[model samples]
Structure formats: C-alpha cells, structure tokens
Target: MQPKKNSIIKTLKLSKKKILVFIFFVAALVASFLFVLKDIPESATIGANNYPQSTKIYDRNGKMLYTFYTTKNQTFVSLDKISENLKKATIAIEDRDFYKHGAIDLRGITRAFIYTVFKKQVQGGSTITQQLVKNSLLTPERTITRKIKEIILAFVVEGVYSKDKILEMYLNQVSYGGTAWGVEAASYVYFDKPVERLNLAESAFLAALPEAPSIYSPFGSRPELGKKRQLEVLRRMEEQKYITKDQRREAGEFQLKFSKIQNKISAPHFVFYVKALLVQKYGARAVEQGGLNVTTSLDLDLQNYAQASVAAEISTLERMNVTNGAALIAKPGTGEILAMVGSKDYFDEENDGNVNVVLAKRQPGSSIKPINYAVGLIKGFTAATPFVDEKTCFPNPGRAPYCPLNYDGKFHGVVQMRFALANSFNIPAVKMLKANGLEAMMATASAMGIKTFEDL
Candidate 1:
C-alpha cells in the first residue's frame, strides 16, 4: 500500500508541474499583450507626417514658377491603382513578408542574426513598418532609445491599420532623393509619368534607386554605379520570383531616359530665393514641415517680356563675345517687382541666376548725367535750367581737368537741362555736381534708385 501511494503522489506532482508551466506561459503572454496595449497611443493610428512645409513660387499669371523644398511631396496611390510590376518589384526589393509580418518579422530577424553572426557583421532586418516608424516618428540618428520608440510605434501602427494602408503610407512617405519625397515624385522626375504608368523595367529601376539615390540615379550621373545597383535589384526580384528570368534580362538591358529639372522654364533662381526666405521664416525644418504656398511679387508676363528683351540684347552683344544678360523690372509706381530675369536658363549658375542687375553697380558711362540733372533740380535748378558746357576742372581729389566729350569725342558747348539729359552731355552735369557738393548728386541718385556709382 505504501509503494502504490508513492506512485500516485508522483503522478499527481508531475501533472501539477505541467499545469504550473502552462499557467506561467499564459500569464507572460497576457502580460505582454497588456503592456503593448498600454504603450500604444491613439496618435499612432494614422501615418505620421515627417516632411516639412515646402515653399512654392508663383508667377503673376498664377503659374507655378518654382518649388523649394527640403523634402518634396510624396504622391500616395493605392496598390490597386499602381501597376502590378511596381508592387512586385517593390515587394521583392524591400520586404517579401510585408503582408504577413505584424510590424516586425521574427523569422527575418532570426535568419538575419544566424547569417550575419557566422560572418561576423551586422545586417539590417528592419521590416517596412519599422522603417516607416523610424522615418515618420523618430529621429534618423541611431540610438537605443530611438530604436525602442520606433518598435513601439510600429507595433501601434500594425494594431491600428491594415497591411495595404501601411504599404501606402510607406510608399507615400519614402524619400527618393533630389528634392523628391516619394516614389511618385521620383517616377515623374525620372520618367515624366505617374506611378500607375510605371512599366516593369521602370518599376524595377525605381525600386533599385532607393538604396543609394545619389549614386544610382537613372540620370546616368554615375552610370556604372547606377547600372550595378539597378542590376542587383533586378536580380533580387528574379530570385524572389517577382519577375522571371526573361523579365530580368529585359530590365537589365533596357534603355533608360532621364529628364532635367535644371533646364525647366520656371525661374530656378527665384525658387532658390523663395526657399532662402522660407528658411529664414520657418527655419530649415519648415522646408520639410511648412508646406507653404508662397505668393511672391513676381509677374510672369512682364518677366517673360523682360527676359526676351535681355535675350535680344544678348544676341546683339554676341559679336562682343558676351553671352549673359540680366534685368529687374519694378512696377512703374509702387516699386513692386514686375519681372526679374536672372538668366537665360533656370540653372545658369554663372548668373547665380539672380544678379538683380538694377541693384548692381555698373560703370555709369554717360547714364549718370541724368542723376546730376536731378541733383541740379533739387538744388533749385529748374526743369528749364540752363548751364554752359566747357572745359572746366575742380581742383580737388587730385583729379584731371574735365573736358567732357560725347562718345564721338564731339564737344557741345552750351546746353540746357533737357538737352543735357536727352543727349547725355557730361560737362554741364559734372559742373553741377562740382558746384552742389557730392552729397547733393548722391541724394538725387538715391531718389531715382541708383544706389552706386562707378563713374566720376
């Protein structure tokens, strides 16, 4: 009886031990669930905004002249809206288990650890959700706290939204470089079309670019480097069976085309100017966060006309080996900028695109004679005032005797203010400045918007 009783007690103890283990496991799982529930906030439900307010520039005609942005707008489209090849290529390139994973992929994490551990290096196992979390809510600076926050937020996002919604958020919020914030913007910049129109080869090419945008842009900037990276994306797509071997070959050798934003008709200089102003107003962060629609004092029709005039002048000066011209036209009465043609092309850096030539100090030649006439007007010299033009000298500043002559070296003796201005005769004007003091002529120049003088 004692031996049988001992056997029964042992069986009961084994059953109790199994029950205790199961209870602990269930408690741990429940505790984890409760903890996750506590950490998730309502704000984590929708996609978090990471981009700053971008500044826009418009012409008088209400056309968009330029856009200055730190990070550009991301055009978000539905999975159903985008091409099938695009969806496949992006999945193949980024995360294959994007749909199955709940914000984080445990299997991927384990596999990555196993592979990289043996090789003695760290490899990223971040899912698209984790990446999105990092991009949206957290600072890009790598740190333990940031990582923790990212994980928490990603989990919250998974709980709140559907897989397709998450994918849309990721696609729309991703940075594709060159002032382009999303895949759609990148597509338009690279292919002059929208995401829905992206072909298989094009889709693969775009998916490949995100790894290193500066290096792998399809613009043939670093063709060898770009081609290599693009090829890698294509090969990965094939390996993942997103595309077949035939598709991969076709993609690998496809002819790529790129458009130049630098050569746009929009005023690039003015765009930069507005961007600088936005940076001043909202700080650098505003360039991404502000999303400002800047209404500038620029007039498009007047700008075009002014540019045409400068172009005409440049053509005339071609024989003199001059290839540059600039103009700044202000509203006749209000001094508002009617037009400003910085240069011939939007990105003509030599012009720095905005010389604001009206504000530039140039060799006055005979143009400054009018300022002296204005000075004479201020000094009680009437509009019908008269002055004698002769060889005269002011004995000061160690200057030479003034024998002011016209461009043809012809000397006109006696001239009235109207003749002096209309003909631009210099002797009478110099005499007037000499008589009225230098400040008087400078004041007159200031009144007329001539701020600097390179002529004596």
Candidate 2:
C-alpha cells in the first residue's frame, strides 16, 4: 500500500512540472506581443498633415507643368456631405460587415490563410480599418512583418477613432484614379459634379474603382472593364440588402458618361512619362504626394510650337482620313526631349487623343527598310549589289507563302541594293532580310536601339 501511494505521488509531481512549463510559455508569448505593440504609432498621430503632399512637375525653364497630389485634388467633406448611396455601395463591395466586425475579421483571415496556403491563391482578407492603416501608416511591402504591423496598426487605429470618423478619413484619403483622390475628387473627376450629386448608379460605378484604380478607370485603356466592375458592385449591394434587385438592375443598366480630361498642362505626354519615371524611382505614393519638385528636360516653348504644328497638319490631312498625329523632338547631342506632342489634340476623347502614340507599339512600315538595308550591307552586300525585284514569295513551313509586293504594285527587275532601298521596294527588302538571316537582322536592329525587334 505504501509503494502504490508513492507511485501516485510521483505522477502528481510530474503533472505539476508540466503545468508550470505551459504557463511560462504563454507568459513569454504575451510579453513578446506587448513588446511589438509598443513600437506601433497611436491613431491620434495620424491627421490631415499626415496625408500626402502634392508633387509639382516643372519644365526645364521652371514653368510649372502639372501638380500631382492626393491632398491637392481632395476636398475634405464630412460624412454627411458625401452621398449615402456611395457609402452603402462602398461598404457592400469592400466590406459588408464593416460596422459589426472589429479591426480584423477572424473568419476572413482564416479563409485567406487557407486559400493562400492550401489552394496557392493569394487573397485580401483585410478589413476597412486594415486598408486605411496600410494606406496611411504602412509602406506597400508584402512581407509577413509588414502585414503584422498593418494588423497591429489597424487595431490601434480602431481603438482611438470612432467608426464614422475612420470611414470619413478613408473616404477622404483613398485614391480614386489618375490624379483624383478621395470620393469628392473622384466625383468631380469622373462625373464632373460634386460628391453630393452622385446618383446610385454613379456611386456604384465609383465604388468599383478603389480596388484597382488604373485598371477600372473609365478613361483608361480598358474602359469597358470599369462597367463590368460596376455591375459586380451593384450585385454585391443587392446581395447585402443595401439596395433592391430593381435598383441593382437599374444601376447596372445605367449608361454613364465620363467627363473628358481637361488638364491644363504643358507637354502632357512628356509630363506623364516623367511622372512614370519618378513613380518607378520613388514609388507611386511618393510621386503623387511627396511634394517632389521635378524639373524635366522639356522646353515649354518648343513643346507648344510642336503641338500647334501637329494639330495644324492633322487638320489639313482630315480630307485623307488622318485625324490624329504625334511628334517627338529630341536634341541630337544629349538626347534631351525638347518637345513631345503625343496627339493632335489631347482632349479628343472620341479618337483616343490622350494615348501617347510616341510610345505606342506600331508597325515601322517603310521606316524599317533602312535597317534591313544596313543589315544587308554588313553581311557582304554592297550598295551596287544586284538583286532581282520580280514577283517573289518566301516559303513558310505549314503555312501559306508570304508573297511580297512593291508600293506601286509594279516590280523593278534587276535593281541595285541602293535603288531598291531608296525606292523602298518590298520584294528586295524581303530578299535582303532572307539573305542576311532573320536572327542577324533582328540582332542588328536591337543593337541600333530598336528594343521592340528583340522578341520578334
């Protein structure tokens, strides 16, 4: 009986030790978490001044070209001033349980973790508070440490600010698209009206842009994508019971007319190009709100002159169906862009006038003939080399033969390399390309600073 009692006592002692170790582990974890939380900023520190400053772009002669900013474009309207439809629409699409949930949604986080780990698909599980913290306080990094910081900051922000205040701050600071920031700015930029004037359909359309501003911008390259996103927003609104099915259908069917871009700036294309470079170097947030004063290599006078010339020339060529034109002038010695006219008229929305044709991909046409001839010259073919310019067809494996023809639809038989190149005969150029080898010609074109030919 004494031996059995001693065995039970020994078992009790082992259990006591295990309990102590578990308690110590939990305490250590709590202490480490507190330590991490101590470094995070309080929500009160984030204010109007914490918002990004406007970046000013200037020409080489100190002429102001454009002012880029979130704050500059933003109008600080109270929650009441903003449309109720926009608020509900944003909540429906962005976060349905925004008011009910805390700073973080446990279910959303769990779902995101499962999708990211087991399914190998990344998903955003951030609440509205988390998004505000990430945009305002945190850098745009995708590291675990950054995410942890974002979550912690979100909690801190929620603890200090009221839910309505947080929503107002978010609506006032979030980027809509292009140079527009916040709902008020977005309203003016997209609808050419005040925030209070936005209808339910317009509100839903605007709400769709915050997820991906550039991709869903109505004036952007894929304009049709914005409408698709708008429909999704309307559907979400209906599902959340924020709107009726009839309202959703009406909003989806509503035809929206986007405001035309009327930016008063010199050298629109060059300014945007330089802005892109700055964004690449300093990040989009910094370029838009860092108060950077960028002095570009563009000459304002030269840019104005070039723009006028291109517009005049395009107008005269309207009889021939040439409705748009672009011109880019650069200095010979330093490669400085003196002037860049992206289109005949930057405000012509019907003809896609805002597109920078100087940087757009296009067939070189006869302009590439010089490079072909140059390649031929390098590959033991001289200017006096004789080439038959008769009807010719290059063979293609498993495809129809590529037949070449001259611009005049008549062949000049037995022409020299110089005459064939000078006249821009298509048949001779094809023969030159075939003789020089496609690989050799492509390499030559790449070497001559034609980057688009490398992939071909």
Candidate 3:
C-alpha cells in the first residue's frame, strides 16, 4: 500500500511538469507574435510645413531665427555624438536597467504597477526610452491601451537598435520645457551653452526638468519652483549613487546658471499662424500634447517689423481706452499665414503658459467687409462691377427697415466694386450683400474661408 501511494505521487508530479512546459511555450509564442523582430515602424513622424524639417523661421537672406518642432525638432543622433556626462546623467535618472531590457522593463513595470494598484497614487516607472516614446509619439493622457503599446514598442526598439542609439534618440527627442525639444536646444536657450558643455550639475538639472516641465524649468518664467526641483534631483542622484555624498552636497549648493525666456516673436498675430497650422495638420491631439513641429512661411524680419508696427498701434489704442490689439500676415496664392502676433505678452506666469490670441476672434469691424467683397468677386463682381453705394434705408423684403453707415458717417454715391472695396467703404458692402440676395452671398462667404456665423 505504501509503494502504491508513492507511485501515484510521482505520476502526479510528472504530469504537472508537462502542463507547465506547455503553458510556457504558449506564452513565448504569443509574445513572439506580438513583437515581431523585423521591420520596425517609425514611432510618430514629426512633420513640417512644405519643408521636411520643422517650420524654420528664416530671415530675408535665409537665416534660422525660430524653429517650430514637435520633440527636439532635430535628427535622432547616435550615442557617440553625446557627452559621457549627459549619458551618465540620463541613464542614472531615467533607466538604470536600460542595457538589459527588451523594450519593457518587467521589474520596474511590476514595481510601479503594484505600488499604484495598492497605494492608488500617480507614479512613473517608465524607462528613458519609454519617456522618449511618450514625448515624441504618444499623448500624456493616461490609458491602458497607450501603456500596452508603449511597452511593446519599447521592447521592439531595444531589440533592433543599440543602447547608444536609443539614448541618442531619447536625448534628442525628449522635451525639456515649453516648446523646447532636446537637451541641445535647451542648452542653447537656457544656459547659453551647448549640450556637450553642460556640467554634471547642469546635466542633472536638465534631467530633472522633464518630470514637471512647466513647473521645474529654471529657464522659463518660474524660477522658485525650478530651484526646489533641482534640489530634489540632487537628492535622488545621491540616493542612486549617481554622485558621491560630497558631489551631492556640492551640486545641492550649486547655483544653476539660468536665464529668462527670450521673447522672440514681437508679432502677436504670428502665434495664430502656428496654432492654425497645428490644428490643421496635427489635429487637436498633437496640439495638446505639444508634439507638433510647424514649419511656416514666416520671415523673421517681416514678422518683427509687423509685430513692432502692431504693438505701436496697441500703445496708441491704450491711450484711447483699448487695451488689446492683434495682427496677421499671410503668404500670397497659398494663403498660408506667415506671421501672427497674438498678444503683447500672454505667457502664463503661474503654470508657465498663455492662450494664443491671433486665432481668437475679435470684432473684425470694417475688416469683415473684405470677405463680403470677396463674395461679390466670386459672383463675377470684378473691381469694375458697379453697385449702388447709397445708405438709403435698408429694409428686409417684408421686415423692419434698417440703415448701415460708413466710418465717416456719410454715404458714398454709386461706385465701382474696385473703388468701394479698396476704399473699404462700409455702405457699399451692406448694399452689395443686399443686392447679392443674401443666400448666394452667404454661400460665397462660406466657400471663401469664413468659419462660423455669429453676427451674420
């Protein structure tokens, strides 16, 4: 009886081994299918206007003044191009286990998952590659679907690319602060140094900037919060043995050589051109994610001139009880907006941002008359097309009588379409719209880029 019981136990143990082996094979096959080793896809493409690189603002002679970009707005470079300190600082802060992982670091993922699942708090355990992917390709909006995709892609990128290649791509594509992509851009914009010249303290500081860009970017409008974050980075660096105790002490006390935000575009209206391009090309997702690189037709020289002219007008308006003003410049034929100055300065001081004004609709006043004239033009009403320019009482066919007046508060007699529109005579527009029989004029305006109708 004892020998028979022992035999039954041995049979059961052998059966369990076979079942476990089968299960392992099934999981391996599924994982293999999910992350096929060949033909990796480019994560997300950062496109520019007409140009392959981001929309670069050039001078009349073709010098780059401002560049619109999604991430770093530059090429993904090789690791050999970067400094050892930057590599160390990034690996120390981002992913200490990058050399060993398949796109997904299961241990880190497990740790983060367990903590969040049990503690119910926001935490980030993503590798540097994951962060770079999120910065360049994915939105920050938290979702399970995005996480799964990120892990799969990370594993695939890791298998295909070398460690240095991944780090180089990460450094170049990551965001440092508001519209500042890549560590090199941040270096030029902030400390006025190149990425290669960044000291350990500065490199650590830049690494810290991504955790909460708007709040911790020392170069941005806010410095107090940035200082606090710098200290936190120092502490973490020490805890991770990235720096010695003495190194941490020295870095903690180190004064970051930061600078104020450069107000490049004096033109408020040109901000609208970029915003419109972002909305048109990348959609609302890219705009909100700050991953859009816009290459525009704007000439910095022309934009600066326009911004100065418009600002002067705003100053004059303030004296007349008008505190706000806006302006725009568009390329001919294509109608691509070259420059848009949104506000005198709308950058947020609190969270470090501002709303764009050029896209915002203000009362066009006489400016709207141009659209109506455009309508008349489309209806074969050339500049020579004659129309009555009388302010004579306007009444609906069977409705209340109304009257429209020109800015001069006087009526122009009969005039040609060219003279009426070029002179911006308001009464002619009202009469023209009335004569075009309302419905046809409405259709014409809709076809000619007039968005919504409020006062129409």
Candidate 4:
C-alpha cells in the first residue's frame, strides 16, 4: 500500500514538470510574437528610386525597339498594365492563400519547414510580400535573423499597402528570366510585345520563370523543364478556380511561339545614335535610370527592309571585294531619316560591321561633278552652252600641271553642258569649277549640305 502511494506521488511530479514545460513554451512563443510585432512599421512606401530601371526605346507606334541598361534589364509597369491572367497565375503558383495570410503564411511555413528538415525536400514558404521585402530591402543571404526581419517587414508592408498595391509591387519587382525583370520587359524579351497583350498560356509560361529563371528559361538548355513548369502553373490556376477545366486544358496544349532572341538591337547604329543623343540631353544616370520613354521617328518596318536589302546587296557585292556596305534612306522634303543601315551585318566582326560607313569620308569620285556643274549653271552657264572636252593640261602656280582626261580615254572634241554634266566628264567639270571660282563653288557645295569640303 505504501509503494502504491509512492507511485501516485511520482506520477503527480511528472505531471507538474510537463505543465511547467508547456507554460515556458507558451511564454516563449508570446515573446517572439511581440518581438516581431514591435519591429513592424505601421506603413510602407515602394518607390522606383530603390533600383535602376532600363530606359525604354520605342518606335513612333509605341513598339519597343530597344532597351538601355547596365546589368538588370527591367521596365516597371503598373499592375493594371499587366494581364489579369498573369496575376492569377502568379498567385495560384507562388501562393494560393496570399490574400488570406497575415504577414506570413504560418501553415505554409510549417509545411515547408517539415519538408525541408525531415523529408529533405526544399520548398519556399515565403509569400509574395515576404519575397518583395527580401528582394528589395534586404540582402539575399539566407539566415535566421534575415528571415525574421523579412517576416516582420512583410507584415508591415501588407498593413501599409493595399492588396492590389502589394501585388503590383511584387509583379514589378520580381525577376522573370535571363536579364528580364518585371512583366513588361519579360513580355518584350519573350513575346516581343507588351505585357497587357499576353495570353493565358503565355502568362502561365512567364509565371513559372520566377522559380528558377535560368533553369526554366526557354533559351536555356532545359526548355522542356520550362514547359513542364508552365503546365504546373496552369494546373494550380485551375485548382484555384482562377481558370476553368477547359481553359486549363487549352492553355496546357497551346503552342508557345517564343520571340527570336534579339541579342542586339534591331537598328543598332540608329539605336546607338539615339542613345548618344539622349545621353547628351539627359546625363548618363538620367538616361539609364530616369525611366525616359523615348519615341523616335524611325520606321521599324522600313528599317528592317532596308537592312535586308543592304545585306542582300552586300552578298552580291562581296564577289567584287566589297566586304561591307551601308545605306541611308531619308525624306527629301522633311529630311526624316527613314532608314540607316550602318553595315551589312552588325555581328560581322571580320568586316567591322559596327563602323558607320554613312559617316565615313571617301573620295566622291564622279559624284561631285553634279555640284560643280550646278554651280556653273548658277553662274549663268546654260545647258545648251558648249565646252571643249580634251586631254588638256592647265598651268599650275606651284604644283605640277593639272591634267584632266575623259574616263573613256577618248576625248569628245566638243560637248554641250548637259552632255558634260550628265555624262560626268572630268575635263568639263574642272572647267566648270574654274569658271564658278573656288570660293563660290565651295560656298555652293556647303549650302547643298556637302560637309566634307568645309575646310577647303
């Protein structure tokens, strides 16, 4: 009977120890909760000043022609500008209970922790707000202190910003793939268009990029993995009721047409020239990060055609030892540069394709004859007037005698001004220049937009 009593007393002692341990656990949890709550701000503000955004270069029709950036290629667009499908897809895949969660998804964190610790399966428990806090304000280093701060900051951010605003900030701040940051730039880099125009399938495809940008990039070696991720996103969207069964099936089966990788700008020379002009006008920093939306008078279609034409002509001219060529098309009336082909191929390093031959100085050959004869006409020389075209030598003051001959090697004894100018007769052109006077001819050429003879 005494032994039985002693056993009961031992049982009571064990119960008391368990109760104390429970109270200690509860106290510790409350203290941690208070610590996190105290650090959270009442309000939060997100601004573009936090990072550098690429200055977008667009054609007159609002088509994205090129982007100028240092490292990260991003163009921020409002949440309203993004496609509804993309928003739904992102939420469905990244965080289903994003709207219902407070600052942190406790359930998701618990599950992820269990999976990471016991199951050895890595999973992210971060909600979109937490991700935004970590990506923008904090460093990428994974630590207990950083994570705690992220959770606290995310809670503060949600309280300050509306759900729509928070989602908008997340969409704009997240990296899509490669160097693409935000939906707008990703849309252009992937679909070659605006983010608002993306379809359901495209949206799903893009939503999957944030998981592992390089690993799921269509341009990368593992394109199939990207496709699989996209399908998973669609499945999640369907499960969330954001998309119907048929819609998910159709999106899953949709053939994705990716935009060709534009490693260089469409019109490299023209774009660079525009960049230089912008830099001159708005300093380097402003041009790079001031988010200047530049609309130039370039006709992209005509420019492409002109580039193709130049490339074709270069191929044909290659046999004649012409390694490269350049072409420029401009309106005679308005002087609007319609197209500027700097070289045959901008990537052709062997031929120095980057050099703008249109700006290069070379002998004008017979091209200058028109200007000289036009000056002669201004000096009262009529087209019907005759001039002797012969292999004649004119006495020079200091230099050797200036001899001029016909290109055909046979001189026509007499030629009319029209025939001389039209046929580009060198001897007649020299005489016309002499008649007009050097200073007057130079002034006439200058007035006609011949910049090469400025010193002369």
Over all chains combined, what TM-score does candidate 2 have? 0.51
Arranged by TM-score with the best first, the candidates are: 4, 1, 2, 3
Q: Which one wins on TM-score? A: 4
What is candidate 1's lDDT per residue for 94-140, written digit by digit as tens?
A: 78788877888898888679879897755568888888777676667
**TM of each candidate vs. truth:** 0.60, 0.51, 0.49, 0.81
Identify the runs in model 4 with alpha carbons over 4 angstroms from their true place. 1-45, 60-63, 110-122, 262-264, 369-392, 409-420, 443-456
Candidate 3 local Cα displacement, residue 120, angstroms: 41
lDDT of each: 0.71, 0.85, 0.66, 0.85
Candidate 3 local lDDT, 1-456, one digit each (tens) = 999999999999999999999999999988765654233346534211121223433444444455455543433334565656667767766676778776767887787788799989545689877776676656677876677666667766666667777777778777787666677667656775557887877877887777788888665577778777666677767777778889887877878777567724333345445556667976754554443344456667776676678668877877678655556788889886666666554453442224456666667677767777777777777888877777577766777787777777876787898888888887778887776777776677678777665765
lDDT of 2 by residue, 23-136 (tens): 999999898777767766666766555566567788899887876775467656789999999999988877778899999988877877999999997756888898888877
In the predicted model 4, the residue pairs found to clash are none
For candidate 2, what is the lDDT?
0.85
lDDT of 4 by residue, 255-351 (tens): 9999887644778888888888899988999888777899988888998999999888878887789888888888789887778888898788988
Judged by whole-model lDDT over C-alpha atoms, candidate 4 comes out at 0.85
lDDT, candidate 2, at 166? 87
Q: Please state the error at residue 298 of candidate 2 in Å.
A: 29
